[model samples]
Target: MMNDRNVVPERRFSADDSISVVETATGKRVDRRDFLRLTGMGAGALAAPALLSGGRSVAEAAEVSGTVPNLLRNGTYPVGLWVAPPPGETTVARYAEIADAGFTFVTGIDGCGGFCPPGETATAENAALLDAAAANDLDAIVYDHRISNIQNHPSEQWRDVIESILGEYQDFPAFAGFDIRDEPNASAFAQIGGINDILGQLDPGVLGYVNLFPTYASADMLGTPTYQEHLARYVSEARPDFISFDHYMLVGARPTIREDYFYNWVLVRNQALQAGLPSWVFILACEHYGYRLPTDEELLWQVNVSLAYGCKGIQYFTYWTPPLPGFHEALVTVDGQLTPLYYAAKRINNNYLQPVGKQLLPLTSESVAHFGEAQPSMGVEVFSGDEWVDSASGSAAILSRFHDPKRPNQRWLLVANREFESTANTTLTLHHTISAMFEFDTSERRYVPLEKAEPTGPATLAVHLEPGEAKLYRLHANQGD
Candidate 1:
């Protein structure tokens, strides 16, 4: 339901305009030189670099080898939402609705309007929310105002404050962890790390989560010279339970995607993979600012692309619509009615994400490749002959390869349709070493055998992908190799 009238004029930088600059998201103008300095980009390079290759280089500096730790209690791939039901509406029915939509966890349990209301403590509200989540079989990540601003208190009192805040909720079956912070600056990593350390000691079973900013953030906002440094500092200093970040790329009144979308994913995925941790992303679920409300295909596109990048968890930006200017229509309306996005999310969650994500949990990402024209400028490998795949041809797509540590010869490939609005028909030419192939059946929650190609020559399989859809295939390699 995006229209031309919603299109905001594209802000382009000009060489002549050396004195001033227009912000990319907001139209507010600021001093050009100052902006460039803050972003760590030179005047000529105001736009994203042809490639932010530093992050990739850092990832490639060592062999890609790490064990992805399981942080969730239920051992399910996390499908979480940013805002839970408000304090007044924290009922069993509402939580049940979320579970019915296929979410395994809820992140914002302090209150729906982003924080607890006046006179109501986050402890009290979160206790009630946890009870509701327990009733519905969903995990809750409690958000406490004191813990989020732990740095403001004297560093000496950090332990006492954190323990006091998390003590009661740690034992709850529904309690997953605490939302330590979101989009924190690099300067705050030490404090965040201290908090994480304390949580590890006091409640070793719980996760102390903190989500990082995307690559598009200003240098001043990131408190680092480059996005690469920001991620590096966070991992080294914060020592987080898992890596999480948000990058809402499908935007604009006319609904064009951002160039840095895949770049951001590549950086985050590499950082997480290098650290031997799981990565989570906040996918856009609402229309806010100039962002268009996503169609069903766009929603699927975001989830499928995140999976293609080896993401282990999916979080929606907002589950309950925020009652604020420029924000509109999330999965649920402000007054508690379900929006079309609710059903769209339900279909995607139940039909694709849940099953595929669980199946991918025990596997390690080996490599990812792109086929056809219109690929991103960076962080993607061109599809060529691999050990098992001879070649892949046809419509543009992404193929992510994975392998189970216990069964190294068995490979898993997830093929995602790059086009959000159209179908893609691709053909995969397999190497003779691939003895058998099977597709993961989401509905049946099992892998079903794929029809064998002619035995006389190299095997080929035709894959048809709907807009924003992906298919998972497992291949067994011949031991003789």
Candidate 2:
């Protein structure tokens, strides 16, 4: 059984409070000061130190390259929100507002930590929400509390309860999947897997969605020795349709990013590739407890970094802020007003995520190379140079290479600025083998010729990336021509 304390609850912590409390993940009691120190929210930890960079040592490249595959099972590039509009605010207009903000889907509609009224029947509300979503060209994941916890019930009642809960919603065109659970322990894998099996058997078209805990979770919370092991067991035992996890690393008053942020991505990206499954990540959107409100660059940083690491989908945590005490300033206010963060997310989704995500959907991740002063550890490969590219000089950046399965000679490179608070001025030197090059135009949703590049032979292209921005380039290699 999953630990009850592991489930996400409304956190209640103040910066100045020194009272002893139980750390949520470890289940160990500690004073408030210790919790702050462990979470990187202590007084002296104002600036984020580069923990991933050290001695320059190149590791052997892996023999196998992982393909992301076409995992857009819902037929749209997913830009989802965790908390949809509250129950009483469920309207076609409300969903239209969500669509206007460039969100493609909404999850946790019925039960997102007391967002819904007490004693509300989620099945009935979900039906109405689905209708609204379909009208606005959006998808929804059903999150009825009873059905989500189906494993806790008797074995025989699983089918009846599942069918009774999900049977009607399946026919709705906007119905994407069922919200199984969030942040489950390894001990609960068998039960979760059984539920997923039945879900697949009954309806193959719909997905079984479950989000895991981030690398920050303690062994006690994960019920495993390490976060990688936790993910491996989840994939093997749960038999999920896709992998999803939430990592709220951008925290503290001064907004220092956690050290293991990229390390977590390395693990998730590798695991997803190995499983041949698409992966999704939850971007932090709300301010609560130790986490501060995300700035525009910070938000874009999260999305672009996830994309660079080959995540297939994006969901914002708490789109509509929960009514809990510590929670505040989500994309939408609790009273239905839009916030500045909402517009920032809108710009990101429309300008970058949707277009780039669609372009990368059918491509395979060949490798990711880190370039600049600070290189992430945990076996992340450094960019020494490649056959088609001589070097990438100036500014820290992440370069992710992808190739089309049918056309091996064609390649795509996504170069993202590593700095969230500063711009990167980069110069990429292409080798003689690259016959043609182009940049993806987000406005046109197509590739346009690189204005500064030569038609053939070695070429140099200047890349200017804003804070947390990434540019997609398409390359054609000469094949013994």
Candidate 3:
């Protein structure tokens, strides 16, 4: 537990200071020590909430200590590497490198085919892998385990195979969790439910994972509305440990790629948020059949955008370039060297994101407000413009973008250009007295100041955005101040 007095020696930001705490009311009397722990304070920061201690309110205890609630405070999540085995190297070497890469977690199994290593040796192999991860103080998650395509195997057989693997190695310290299948269509959700049932029968302690499409497809098919409904069935009815999804960027998709993706992320994730589930995203680092591999900048965008939308963990597509070449696109080069994307992970994890994680482990929130139509159309509604401005208050504010009261500092705004590749003129006015505005670049993982408007009381700001690009704003101000 954190001590409030020790957490906050003094206020860091103030009215007299250049940066004031902008959103909501000030001096809310937060517990400092708890804040430090929740906000991922300095190394000397207090410890995290003790979980499973006889059903105590871990969040409340941390809050009483002085920590703020879990929100986007700071820090790149501690980065994890998806270990790839070289052409001839045994699984042991792969495990060693995964630990060496500073990744505490490994996803999927070692072999290339659709089956986990067979027979009695499978348990021994799993134990060895667990030993390697533990020795390096790393955590390992076995996802897309060697179950053949559901198209090939019956759901019952799939359940049996998954059950055996879980039963054999449920006690291993290195086992992080299990993702039942890679990508399943709507029809496969039932199989996923069956797998979950089997896993529970074996070891209820381990987490069950499944991947959904990038955007929620309609239940009519696999799109958002329907997918959300189906997902709810599993969550409420099946009650799995955690929910995971595959978020991929097609080759040559859009102008503001990151922005486009972020909105999609928000739409789909908002559903998971409503379900109150911890979410993880599977990012595409490798090139699909004919698609191109993601560049370093694009890779950073995937991680940052997902994190901004509040994904607690990330899953990478391929770590090793397969010996067969044509189908192999990996974060590492063919020779098995770390690609630029690897460094991007290191930088965010070791520095910016890690510090923030120390403070608030971002859990999904139900405080989202949807604007306009869903994706493939205008990603976000153009809220700030000549028509939307308030002439009397001389302020520009979009009521549609306002947040639900449930979230503390739970505010987010989506702004974008009307025309693709065309710069447009727009002004954003704040209904409330404007104190501070910040925009985060998902691709770059940096924040920039939107030049403050010239007029004082009325916040009139000019926005020049390219097509397909959108800005997510974090606004701060006291209510009725």
Best by lDDT: 1
The sequence of per-residue lDDT tens digits that candidate 1 reaches over residues 1-481 is: 1122343312112332112223333444444334323322222322211111122221221123122222553468899997666666789999999999999889753422122233234355566778889999888887665676665578999988776665555456677677776677677788889988877766566678888777776676677889999999999999987889988777764348877888898898899899988889999898766667899999999998899888989999789875544456899987889999999999999888988999987677888888885645466677877888899889988988998889977999999998888899999999888888999899999999987768677777789999989999999988867
**Each model's TM-score, in the order given?**
0.83, 0.82, 0.58
Per-prediction tally of clashes: 0, 0, 32
- The positional error of residue 404 in candidate 3, measured at the CA in angstroms, is 10
lDDT of each: 0.74, 0.72, 0.46
lDDT of 1 at 314: 95
What order do candidates take by TM-score, descending?
1, 2, 3
> Which residue ranges in model 3 land beyond 4 Å of their true spot?
1-83, 86-102, 110-121, 143-171, 194-205, 215-238, 252-267, 353-360, 363-476, 479-481
lDDT of 3 by residue, 64-90 (tens): 323211111123353454434532333
**Window of ten residues with lowest summed lDDT in model 3:** 1-10
Which candidate has the top score in TM-score?
Answer: 1
Indicate whether candidate 2 or candidate 3 has the larger TM-score: 2
